[model samples]
Target: MSEQAPHPATGLSALLASTPFARAYTHTALAAVFAAFAVERIAGSVALATILGGLAVLGVGILVARRAEYSLVRLAPTTLLMFLAWTLTTVAWTGDRGRTLAGWVALAGIALIAVVVALVRDTLQIVRALGDVLRWLLSISLGIEILSGVLLDIPIPFLGIQGRIAELGPIQGIFGTRNMLGFATVIALITFLIEYRTLSVRTGVALFSVILGGVTAVLTDSPTVFVVAVAVALVTAALVVVRNAPPERRRVLQWVLGAIVVVAGVTGYALRSTLIGVIGAGTDLSLRTDLWSTLVPLVRFRPVYGWGWFGPWAPAEFPFNYVNAVLRESHASALNAYLDVLVQAGWVGLLLFLAFAGVALLRSWLDASQRRSVVYAWTPLILVALLVDSLFESFTLSGFGWFLLVLCAVRAGQSRSWRERMRSLDGPPGGVETLPAAGGVQGPDISRG
Candidate 1:
């Protein structure tokens, strides 16, 4: 007997679930959203970039929903939701209701995109995609520098290329600020190195990526970038030690290393004056302090509810405007993520933010130490970078920073949440297993990682 033709809906469903289609869909979706991370720099308008990214996210989301699988119960980490709820509630009390609503959309929309991306792609896939994206962006930055500095001998003011490459140092790439370029390279370097260790990309490609990131970091001459680089290196070494230890000893080593980190932080704070000058970050530190001091009166006024959540301080807004006017500068953020949170959302909000980050970092760090593959290490290492850098920059609060923060939290939760512990109660004998994020995909064995 002859078979009847398949229905269009069924045919489309099968195609979407197929391996090749799934691969293509994930790659296209990730690439589009990642590009939007810096789309504002290219388009020169945050609103435009937000609108463009939302459209891209919606398009990919609709296409993937045909086959995508997710549970509302497990869509995102609970701590993250708590923090978001706090931010949402701020809308009820904030003076500028319209701006707060707009700000909330930017914060929530990017987070939603991060959740969707995590739902579709596996860890190795995410690292590889990010590695590829950074390589392209860094290369373009260098190419632009060469063109502006060597050929044109003029600044590309529109995109913030300062034509300083001919001078051989302190050049900002397409990110518009040298510090931002340096920060991006620091992350790129970490991603490239992890990608190399995982052997997820070709050896030559990985080596080239590392070099590109390294070269960009040098050209930017950003002190914070160097500090972040050193911090990442230290964490990498500690993780390596823990990872190579016997499985039984790994837990002990983790505690020992963590204690050392605490001691180092204490020591660093005690020697702040000497360390600042020695590290040549004095200028940067002082600038941040000046901006931070301006927040006292504003924060004192609200103290608990904050002046309200303006992710990036809108110059035209009431309290934010007053702050800049006093400082005699146009500062978008307090420059410290913690302080920024304190001034915007108050002590209560700050505590929630820390709790959200703390839970994710602790979970991801434990997972990395216990998991066998080097790929498992990426999440914790990236979290360390983000958290350490947050001390100096408010990048983690909005835009790409917020996106990454949520992405890591979601990834870590999927791999090592309490839910897995409950699941193990029913399905497995002694070990916990992470349920597949979506159909046709598998998750790592938790074994309590």
Candidate 2:
């Protein structure tokens, strides 16, 4: 018998399913929203920020709900939930309860969004989304800075433009800080490298991004960029080489690497003063030591729970007064991610965050090494950059760095290597034998680096 014509609703559903909206539009839009938080700074308008954040959160929820079957039983979810829960609890003790609540909501929203992206998009889509967003953000920022300097001739204070208009920098671009611009440059360079390596875009475009990022970094005089760039390069190179090595050589290389790490840590710790001098840093770290010295002792006052997450310093408050007196400038952060966490969340929040970061990094590293495609490497590389940057800057709770962390954590937790963990938990069924695998699964038909 001939088949009956399909129902109208069924046909519409099929057409919708075939559409590329989810593949092309959704991920890109989500990335743009995330970038806006950093690029626009949401103009510190709580209402605008809330609307944008809500949109992102809603997008993630919708996407995840559309999936046929998905698992939330993963490391990323556990760690993030713990972190978010702790952050929310802090509102109870926070001096400024309202701000603390806002901070918690923002954190939770991004974390959930990251999890959704990880669950829905594969590695290639993730990279593409990141590349597209950064390409636009960095490019627009560079263009604006040039315009403000050359044509406007008026300092764009909001964007942090100042000094002689002819000078290349220290231009803050749309990021509002030279260091922030530097950080964006580093991320841009990495994203462009991935795009170039994957042949996802024309070679010239990727090369241009690299060159632009490099030039911006130089002009900005962001020392952190140089340090982070070198570190990421070395680590990436090591990972690539080791991943490509034969099984036997891989084992030896890992041991050698471990030994090197141990030696380097000891050496770095022992000669930290000398190294700082070599890097042209004073013992006081350009007056940062003074801030640290003041804050460290004060942490003892609320050593267990912290003063509270994202605590706004009331003028007469103990730590705020002390910090402002020493720095001679109003400061929001301790200028160190670890210290910020310790000060805000106390030991409990710090420990939870550390555990969260550790799990994410470990999972991402494993996935990168196991995967055949180099695009996977971006996850760990970005994580490494975040870790390195956090040592000098308090970006852990900020927008981009935190967003990247959540993204990486979710990606890592859901990587194919993680499937092995599931298999371990529920071993092969009786009388069902598995055949040897041919090779690692291909990633999105993209070129292998």
Model 2 C-alpha lDDT per residue in residues 1-449, reported as the tens digit of each score: 99999998666544333325445534554554445534455456565566557656555544444433343355254777898889799889977787778777777766665655554556666676777777777777777777777878777665566733267577676676777778888887888887777777777877887888888888777667777888898888889888888867877887887798789778978997887787665733666677788889879999999877763344455566678887697776777888888888899999998988888888887777766667778888989899888887877566667878887887776643444467456542111111112222332321111
lDDT of 1 by residue, 1-449 (tens): 99999998777666654545545544554454444434565665765555646544653544454323443546678888888888888888888988887788778777876765565566766777778777888898899899999999999887778899989868877676788788888888888877777666778998899889888999998888878888989988888788778998877787888899999999999999998998798888988888877787778888888878879888998787888899888988888899888888888899999998999999888887777667767888888878888988888987667878888898888757765665444443212234332232336632211
Pairs of residues at least 3 apart in sequence or in different chains that clash in candidate 1: none
Segments in model 2 whose C-alpha atoms lie over 4 Å from true places: 1-44, 163-165, 281-284, 311-318, 416-449
lDDT on C-alpha atoms for all candidate structures: 0.75, 0.69
Index of the highest-lDDT prediction: 1
TM-score of 2: 0.84
| Clash numbers, per candidate | 0, 0
Model 2 global lDDT (CA atoms, 0 to 1): 0.69
Off by over 4 Å in 1: 1-38, 41-47, 50-68, 422-449
Error of 2 at 292 (Å): 1.3
